[model samples]
Target: MRDLAELDDRVTHCAACPRLVEWRERVAVEKRAAFRDETYWGRPVPGFGPPDAAIAIVGLAPAAHGANRTGRMFTGDRSGDVLYQALHDVGLASQPRSLRIGDGLSLRGTRITAPVRCAPPANKPTPGERDTCRPWLARELLLLRSTVRVVLVLGGFGWQAVLPVLGAAAWRVPSPRPKFGHAARATLPATDGGPDLHLLGCYHVSQQNTFTGRLTPAMLREVLEEAKHLAALA
Candidate 1:
């Protein structure tokens, strides 16, 4: 637990990617109209939830005006509205919505994180940038490994990013990596006698998916419930 806190502190101070550093700071300064009076977190965001979480959710990156502004993963974002509601419905979350940091929203037996801690421009991180930010994700997974049984990836980006990290942590990768798609599932056996890992895929809860019916509350809830069941948190 102490190690996780230290990791979070380190993540918050990272300036590894010059483009991400400049862009995040720029967005923080040029406040959005709705948040004109509010202060932006601007720094890299860290994973949120208990250290002993059984389920770990991997997202692509912090939303520029969402986690980037609020300093909490998925908070103050439309994606969060869709995600937290499903989690709540499935009994994995304390509330149905995540607004700001300290909004009393909490996860039960689950943690939410991202491969890229910093908010990327256009809500997309380049391949190089994703690789550069991977060490943090790798370390975080290590810290959570003892209890983590299910890894729920939000999109293809997260699916790709997390697989390598899992491999580095000694979780057995399949001969041919599984493809990413909504409701996809892959079981990763342990190489070091640890618990086997269950990897589940779900479409990102971004506005593009949710607003277009590509991902619905029912769909999201199904995935979350499956994750909960697999993690033995149901």
Candidate 2:
């Protein structure tokens, strides 16, 4: 795609994976008890934020009832609750909540996206599905390469998924490849002589992590602050 607008438009219409298409659509129709009266997006979700973002937040995939219901990444979900609040606390978000599309929520110099565009069954996308969706992320990072200086990856799945995309974007991933861990850090040099990219890892803000006290708001904010510093946004 020539631009992020076109990329996002294309993403919403993607049906490349039959399984992902079926699962996302089925969940929309079945409707969770609480959201039965509301309409579900049941479509692929695109990255969120401005085109000139200096920082990117990568998550695993859209949640079945969360982004699937609201048609926006991290919207209407507990995971989003923790994430957006942390961004706001760190002065990167316009507001602390991501309720739905057009909620007036905005990220300053940051974009949030996932490796998988379509929400998968049981929150898991097969290896094939992740590979099939790789081009989208690759193109997105390429489009943002001029401005994106830092990538804050949430969880190991996103960490693993993004490394290859970074390489594809001309960022030289290390030979051994950096392992994933909370607060993990890696600096990837652009083979094309572009600005270097900084990668930061943090535990996902999923309910499992937040509820268990594994990923506190403070911890999340710390990472965001660090990303801002790395991106020169602070």
Extract clashing residue pairs from model 2.
none
Off by over 4 Å in 1: none
Residues 1-234, candidate 2, lDDT per residue (tens digit)? 899999999999999999999999999999999999999999999999999999999999999999999999998899999999999999999999999998899889999999999999999999999999999999999999899999999999999999999998879999899999999999998899889999999999999999999998889889999999999999
**Ten residues in a row with the worst lDDT in model 2?**
166-175
What C-alpha lDDT does candidate 2 achieve relative to the native structure? 0.94
Candidates' TM-scores?
0.98, 0.99
State how far residue 97 of model 2 sits from its true place (Å).
0.3
Residue 119 error for model 1, in Å? 0.7
lDDT measured at residue 136 in model 1 versus the true structure, 0 to 100: 96
